[model samples]
Target: MTDRHELILTCPKGLEGLLLEEARQLGLEDAREQTAAIRGFGALEVAYRLCLWSRLANRVLLVISRFPTTTAETLYEGVRSVDWAEHLEPGGSLAVEFSGRGSGIDNTHFGALKVKDGIVDRLRTASGERPTVDKLNPDLRVHLRLDKGEAVLSLDLSGHSLHQRGYRLQQGAAPLKENLAAAVLIRAGWPRIAAEGGALTDPMCGVGTFLIEGAMIAADIAPNLKRERWGFSAWLGHVPALWHRLHDEAEARAAAGLARPPLWIRGYEADPRLIQPGRNNIERAGLGSWIRIYQGDVATFEPRPDQNQKGLVICNPPYGERLGDEASLLYLYQNLGERLRQACLGWEAGIFTAAPDLGKRMGIRSHKQYAFWNGALPCKLLLIKVELDQFVTDNRTAPPQPNAAPAPVEVARLSEGGQMFANRLQKNLRLLGKWARREGIECYRLYDADMPEYAVAVDLYRDWVHVQEYAPPRSIDPDKAQARLLDALAAIPQALGVPRKKVVVKRRERQSGTRQYERQAAQGQFLEVIEGGVKLLVNLTDYLDTGLFLDHRPLRLRIQREAAGKRFLNLFCYTATATVHAAKGGARSTTSVDLSRTYLDWARRNLSLNGFSDRQRLEQADVMEWLAADRGEYDLIFIDPPTFSNSKRMEGVFDVQRDHAALLDLAMARLAAGGTLYFSNNFRKFELDLSIAERYAVEEISAATLDEDFRRNPKIHRAWRLQAR
Candidate 1:
């Protein structure tokens, strides 16, 4: 064996520089950074030390050979060139991992197979025995990377990803990989903070990844000290004595570190269910003495360390995956900022978030920002010192006077135009409030472009307000429109007697393709509003339209009133609001169809929320395609399709104006004898096909479908009741 061996340390993207620095610090020579990896030359002892110590590396690959290859045969020849007897026994089990794609190797599986065959053939020829493939716990794990017509083959010295750490068996949704968590801590200055004997806290700890990693850093404990298995565990070149020496040293260092006074390390998770699991993980990591986890909400999170010590408040808050989650996440981030200010005034904070825009809304300024990749998603680590200077405050507000009477709370003052808008809102509330209460409607439109200058729709979902600014015509001055929008936004909270946070605002513009269904924000804030005595969930901030169409309130209620003792079908059922109503109306059965799995999942929730899951079917398919194959008869049918939809899920574009006749014809086929089909659309210029009246009894019910809230905009949607002649 050579005294010096080439080493390649692979890490997550954006961690190469940090890994390179770590490798050099660990006594690796000639360390250099590459994309997502660090390369260096080191002795076998140094390689073992790196495997035991590196917290940012995914794998430590000890390069065996690097050769140019342009075809499958060259790739096989390169793998065969490496002496198999030196690395693995002839009868041992091995696993091959191949990455990159080029030089006639376009598939990783095929490339891995070729490499495995090369190794097997060479071993068989040398010793009359070949290693079998064991993917799970192999004696040898070889890796081959094909890049730019070159294959770099290496023996994987670290097995099962060094990040495994043998501690975390159960984790929360979207748990950060341990190495990535370490990188976040390292970049956030956790090592420096720990070296100073400062405390650490993760307010939104999920299964306590941050807490464990932070504790390990503070205690000088090797991350892989407890790991019993490695890629080199059973290799022919495995130096048991050398590894044992390093392992014992790490053990002694850990014991000495633990013998000292433990650092004040704690984690708080909002989920009660994760408390025990987090503690279990801590105990498994042998960090229970230094770390304590408790069930605590971020809003009330406070780090109470001995002797009033200050440390770091670090958290990886949820970067919402679903739309409408951002609305609630906004408040969550705001609360975290508030808690940091109120409790950790002298402390530092490291906030890792994928959504930097939400980080900006925290009302605190970060001193430093580091870019990182959480898997494929780009994220930011915002470092902030929780000082008075870092607290962002409204510049308009005067500073508090010392030893003076408390000033009265100042309300946002509206401009002349804003006051007019506010007055109009107040007047509408007076008239609409009485009607809403009398009709038992909790969700209703308060104002819809009532004042031309405002050109915005204000909707009341119980106590919350949803304001949508309609894109002004191109003829209108953009600046003027924006000013008017700002005025209306300022006036909404005051006029509606709601907190500013409860008001969700969005801009309404013409959308193309699936843009309308795309999330406007990831707030995931759902508000349940009562309409027609059926409980329904509505997300006011996630998508372009709230889950429930306020304009279609009357139509949904009418469905509820007329759906008893019948099989009801709802097409283009975004969230299945109408289906819920129909089910609540005592329908025998209900089926809702839509192409979006997002909405379909929501529809399932709505049905489940309303206790209508039994006999309630939610199908995820193109409505036009589903209608063609559906053989079940429905006594009552309601279809409210988009004016134009070119979703990739569908075969072709659907223009309601052009295809309404065919659409109605197919829907009529599914209508049972004496069944009634209610067709409605929001297209302002939608015209019912004349041929429909000729073959069926058709009555225009556009006026009847308009509720009091939509009375002003009766053109919001047109409805029709059709029955076969």
Candidate 2:
């Protein structure tokens, strides 16, 4: 076989260009992008060098053979054509990673199995023995690509993705992959920054990916220097001597680089649990002495006094991974902008996020932006120069230059609709304010799209206001709807006498699947509020629906009133607000079930706040799955699932309108004789199946469930009391 072979390097999407640049830097010629993977030509030594040094490439694949293959038999024949015995010893282990689904292969799993079968059969024919497949760690790893009726087989030169630099054993909840982190640093010009003796900081560094990767770049350390194994080490054509020579040269370079004065690197994490893991990663990378991980908040981030003023402040700030996180993360991004402005005057900052719109809230002008990918989510790296001119001016700043044209007045502050919205808000506050105080309700809906133009729901949790903008119809001009939304948001602070910062704005719409429960922020700031004589925790910014659903207050009150020495069950128990009411209502025992750990924690905090630890249970489970398995009977049950949910945590999509009947049947199956099921949903057009009504005694309790605060929008939710006939 020729020592030179066709080569392909796969990388994360959106980083193909970066990988191409990296491949060129590693002396690979004729490098060009091929979908998400890069194609290149290089000799065996060059390929071995890439496996040891290329930071951005995920896998280094050496193309072995290619042939036209459409049917499964052709794919198997193509694989059989390759001399498998030459690559893997009989009775040894092998693995196949198949991508693409052309050539009649409809499933990747099935394609991989066919390739595996070819390898086993060929090896069995050659030596009367077959290599067992090892999915975890195979002696020989083969990659098969099926494209346009063509099958190309290659040996993975890297046993694992090169991004696995063998340094990080622990990571944050959403740490950037090591190679991705390196790419971000490269885009931010971290190597140049460090070479010039500038300091580096990641205010929201998770598990020290950026810091460790930056250290490696600055020290010129080969990314995989610490990695002990490579696919080539076990290959039949392995050139051990050539690899040893390259490894020795890399080791010498790293040792000499480490001897120099270390670059200044710092990482800050708010979660203390991540701090130690970050420190562990740094130590594992042999960068403990160079990079420092600290437990600190981003708002308090300041460059070390001994560090240089100019460097890179890069972080993959918790991008709103869930629907509701965007609102809470707005403040975080704003805080980051503020910190960059006040603390690091000359530093360059890069914020990587999936929701680039949140970058606008950061209050800084991006000098440049680069596209990247975090797994499948399209994202951007926003680069900003941390200087006074880039910072947002204070509201009280001096007027513009005398010769400058007058700026357009903001529509929210002076629009006619703004006044009407404000007036309606004031009227509702007066009407509901007194009622809330008299009833000890610290949180209540003050407005529910009361005005046509102002299509938003405003709620008050004591002093703070939660603003939820209902998505306007396509018939309405998006710009006009946005203007009206801004006007309404502006009106809330003035109308409610709350500070602008105290107002949290989130766009609320009928969510598909599990988007409603996805995390949008990790501020972890919960405010306590009194409701139905119990204190509950509500996180306005971190979630679309604050931990407590204001519309459910009446239903919770009824649960409490009806619970006295009776077992109570709260299903779809978001934040367990209903369970709290039941526990406080003197229930004999209470059980709460939901799938979100974040909400479950909030629920625990709410229960703890009320000092109700007696016999309440909190479980993280899919309500539908839990209901089917539940054999215990409860005297009372509350089922208020989301209108629709498609969370991957659940087995299938849940449409309250479509699945309510089955859901109610499952809940009723676990109900004691004469027990009542208070089934409700926010599906505005929900119609109770007449068949269900005929089989059981059912009463529409929606009207009775609406309190003084929610009467304005009784369609917000529907409720019914069902009993076994």
Candidate 3:
């Protein structure tokens, strides 16, 4: 009985509860989510069983102990205090991985080494032998997480991140973790869909994580069975019978299941960049002959013609964050909408996006929507009824009048979005009024250059060019949105004195190459800095978002002044405008986070012209992970995460409108004592959930963050300033 040990498992965020339920269904007691990981005290059998059976885990880390440690020295002491002699061999090779530091520690390597030395020292002291550190193939793995001054250390029972799932032999540029993909499918209700042998497809499948997970679910294949070995296998005095019973049962279940040809599942992606990897991923899943993947644009993608079992189409499309060029992206979106209505009949469509406005383009009355993280970008996976025309016409009419004061619309509220949209809108409006100053223009740039929203504006002298953008609006219909933008732009020609012939309204599209963005953007060239001495607009609104955000103007000024000598950290910083403002204000240094390489270049230009280009630092990362990893202090920190975003390729979804408090708290944590955290969200009716500001001195600085151009619409920015006292 002494052999029975306690172990904790962790699933990715949001799947903890489900993983716990799964464990419960298996009759495993004390199995539940603990923090981002899961916890369960069971015999070594449960630990081994979970490794083979879990479908939604990043990895299975056995908890050696969970303790509170504040500093580097404390972490070492705590680690040394653990009974390392109980597990690691004196002469064994082991490794330690440190994650979730979040502006707490400066160097992760130092922190990881400290914990490692502590473990080895403990072993050396007792056993007269020490284990060599092997980061890749360690005999024993240790995990150290220092999040917000607290540390949770666990033994890495699953050598690789559990998401490895033993599938996906090849790596794509941004492949979705298999475990995350499974969670997405499950969250989207895949079991219900899979039970019917309903086919499932991922149009943007980079490496077939979703498709494989879906297939595994269909075949009853345990996601972990493919892993030839697990950490517990090497445990001393391991019970072979119990482990064998679980492994054999799982294997038998997978083998005995009928894998109706993979024709029921498919994946398609336009960029052939993922084709080779997709093939490898399918092969790795042992489903090369079972699943099909095609290299093509989603617009032209047709559902499997042979199989009559219409299935669900789940996809994670490109968003403005990483794939800029909004107007052009509209075409892809409009076409996808067309495809959703046309090709996916009788089949349900699951569209995951951080951009709610983009979701509207699909033109379907969604059956369900799931909130998740696509890295730091807040996103939603909308499960829309495929029979849209019928569903919309028969079920949900055009609400009598499109813009009629949104009467008593009862959204079967998911406890997530948090606030009443109308109430939040009312508050944001009152707060942002003092900041919206009208620069003479034909149209007010609603989202152009605002946080989360990346639409831009161009100027021709007094008159300005306005481009309309909907930042993944969930409530608005895309076709209606398109009409609204057209109307807004139509008035621009009359308002700006530029004839419709010269107006040149270009709906932003993805820039195919650096040459295209620069070349196309240069076409309608002219210059002006009309209002507030705002300069530099080459022909106003051409290819992408104009030049600047009229809303964040006030906030930029704040940065310009307060930045004089403080280090600046810009999370989700695009175009480097804020950094320029900070550098111009005499900031010591600026670090900007953005995934797009194009915008980084543009930011470099904006800063270079202002003589602060040399001070800018750029990091291409999924903001959530990056911010979690960043321990560097900044005097001024600016984060404007998108309304709804998910880089399914990155294993998380982000929804600013829903995840604001958490995002703000994390960003604020990075702020130095007495430093300023300037956070903004363009979620129209954003309400800062003050409850989360408990850790810091929080204040609503909406008026201060608002810019001159956004004076007309007071709800453009939900801005705040938080300070760590």
Best by TM-score: 1
Q: Write the per-residue lDDT of candidate 1 for residues 1-725, one digit (tens) a residue.
A: 89799999999999998999999999899989999999999999999999999998999999999999999999999899888999888899999999999999899999999999999988884437678999999999999999899899999999888998989988998999999999999988999999998999999999999999999989999999999999999989989999999999999999999889999998998899899889999999998899989888987787957546988888899976643343456667767876877788889999999877667657688999999999999999999999988886443332222233334333434568977998899889889988988898888999999888989899998878887878889999976775677667666655666655788877778877778787877768788777887888988777888888888888898999999999999999999999999999999999999999999999998888877879998899998889999999999999999988998788889899999999899999999999999999988888788888998999999999998899988899999999999
Decreasing TM-score order of the candidates: 1, 2, 3
Error of 1 at 414 (Å): 14
Q: Which residue runs of candidate 3 sit more than 4 Å off their true CA positions?
A: 1-4, 66-83, 98-114, 125-128, 144-153, 171-173, 237-241, 258-263, 304-308, 321-324, 388-725
- Residue 296's lDDT within candidate 1 is 83
lDDT of 3 by residue, 124-199 (tens): 8453767898777877888887766677787767777667776677766656667767877887777888887677
- Write one digit per residue (lDDT tens) for candidate 2, span 1-725: 79778899999998899889889888788988988889989898899889999989999999999999869998998898888767888878988999989778999999999999988888885437678888878899999998888888999999988998888899878778999999999999887888898889999987899999999999989999988888877788888999999999999999999999987788899989898888988999999889998888887888655544578899988865553343456557666776877788878988888867667556678989999989888899999998867765444221222134334321112246866888898888778888987787888898988777788888888878888888889899987775676556545655666545688888888677777677666777889888878888888776667778888888999999999889999998888989999999999999999988878888888888999887989889998888888888899999888888877788878887788788888888888898898988887788888788877889999899999988888788888999999
Give the winner by lDDT: 1 or 3. Answer: 1
Give me the overall lDDT of model 1. Answer: 0.87
Cα RMSD (angstroms) for every candidate in the order listed: 8.6, 9.9, 19.2
Q: Candidate 1: worst 10 consecutive residues by lDDT? A: 395-404
lDDT of each: 0.87, 0.83, 0.65
Off by over 4 Å in 1: 68-78, 101-107, 125-127, 147-150, 395-442, 447-458, 466-681, 688-714, 718-725
**Per-prediction TM-score to the true structure, in the order listed:** 0.71, 0.68, 0.54
